[model samples]
Target: MKPCPVLSIALALALGLPVPARAQSAPGQGGPTVIRARDDALYRELGGQEAIRRFTDDFYDRMLKDARIAHFFDGINAAYLKGALADYFCVSAGGPCDYDGVSMHNAHAGLGITKGDFDALVEDLQQAMDAAGLPFATQNRLLARLAFHHRDIVTR
Candidate 1:
């Protein structure tokens, strides 16, 4: 389904807000060009902060109920996890949310999180995004941002 017109406009504004000069990109030859901060287009496309919060909430709810990944959440504070995820997504999507959670490395350190578990988490997140009816581009954008943290979160 097409996004609502109002959301489309908010996305544009959220992404088009002037970024700092240091965050600007220099012209480069072919291949992917990197922007210092989060991509505004992707952020706007994701429907901004409220959408992110909804996505995170739904994602965690699914994770908690899924037998495949529920074990990983054992002993973890569900509320705290949800709050941290909200903050993380907020920052990751170029919103104004502040993430005060421990660095990914430190947070997952000694948790014995294997690559398989990490992949499962990604799959579940994808499922959650799809269930939320987000566009594919927005899903990919969020996934790409989260993928960078795998190195720090996965011990194996």
Candidate 2:
């Protein structure tokens, strides 16, 4: 079998992918983010699932090392998160992948996540995208799709 990746939305918020594992999370309790993709264009630009997996791998490393947000991932199974996150991103990018993780709201409930944390997470994601060699316009396009998820990740 192919090697799977680590954690997500912070895994994606970084895509707020910093939720508990499927066994521990609410398991698809919340609604999905509806992104109007122009027919897999974004997915292709993102280099497909392989590219996403690489970006996610780097993204998780960044989050775990960042003092500003690493605490949130304590004891979490990053491998499991990475798979779910890739699917979320694939779906967001218009690929034919199924997102089976919990809702953004459900994933981050009671985490006391603040706007600052969300921003930090997004920053890390941007850096990861940059490292992944994603073009400026392409990165912006993807980020725009994920922007709405902020409300769910950074609950007051």
Candidate 3:
């Protein structure tokens, strides 16, 4: 006789609850467990490289037009900026791309970037993510990773 699917699932869940192993061992006997890295959900969610490219383009376009952050980007080559952004995003989303751009501390070292400028850029990024139809959790995760570098990127 076969068990009902729901019943089987319920039983599995109930029996799978965490329990101490029966093997005798000294305290702290387990060796360090190596965790395998999971595939990047961001890449899957953003539809991969092409989508990342498009999003970077749109994000920079908006930044150039927005008065709030335009001054910070002034005199910066748009093509270079776009390429750098693509590289950053590609690495950020766990793609195989390598970012050869300068580190945040070196890139903005003398730029005197302020908190307001950083905030504006983040806002624009959020807009770009939303425009690309990214899920809220994915957007937040990406942003959180970027946010950690704010101290290095923002001089003021």
Candidate 4:
């Protein structure tokens, strides 16, 4: 499979390329893990926990309606999953969140997800971030960390 664009774009932005202003990981079991972060700059840019929660909700809504990947969540609980996703994103963005959820590798172990599914999900996230008023760079920052999980999530 081709590499996810999120990683490269995030690296470019981190390396000094500009991202247009817009609106919007880790591995293993742990008490609380933060993805390769030095600070909470992304958390701040994301407008904190409340905002994160909002976008996560929006993301799930989009995902549930998307035919390409909707089946993946067939037996899942929407409310609970949305909250978990919020916490996950919060932690991923370097916020003060204690995400005690399942690891990406474990959570998706038998899901049989594909590159298309992953990309569609990422697109849903961008839509959510856009709706939440996250700037381009902020979206990329969060995506950069989350994209690292592509290896863990895409099992197909």
Q: How does each model score on TM-score?
A: 0.73, 0.78, 0.73, 0.80
Pairs of colliding residues, candidate 3: none
- Cα lDDT of model 3 by residue, 1-156, tens digit: 422323332343444322222212223423211111134565667778888889899999889888988987878899998988887766665666656566666677888888778767766776787888876566655565465456677777
lDDT of 2 by residue, 65-117 (tens): 99999999999999998787777777777777767677777888999998788
- Candidate 1 residues lying further than 4 Å off, grouped into runs, are 1-39
Give the alpha carbon lDDT tens digit for every residue of 1-156 in model 1.
633333433343454433322222223322112222444665677777788788888889888887877888988888899888877766666665566566676678788888667766766676777888887667655666666555677797
Model 2 clash tally, residue pairs: 20
Number of backbone collisions per candidate, in order?
A: 0, 20, 0, 6
Tens-digit lDDT track for model 4 on 66-108?
Answer: 9999999998999889988898787776688777677777778
Rate residue 103 of model 3 by lDDT: 62
Model 2 segments more than 4 A misplaced: 1-28, 33-38
Q: Which candidate number maximizes lDDT?
A: 4
Q: State each model's CA lDDT, in order.
A: 0.64, 0.71, 0.63, 0.73
The alpha-carbon deviation from the true structure for residue 144 of candidate 3, after best TM-score superposition, in angstroms, is 1.1
Candidate 1 has a TM-score of 0.73
Q: After superposition, how far is residue 112 of candidate 2 from its true place, in Å?
A: 1.1
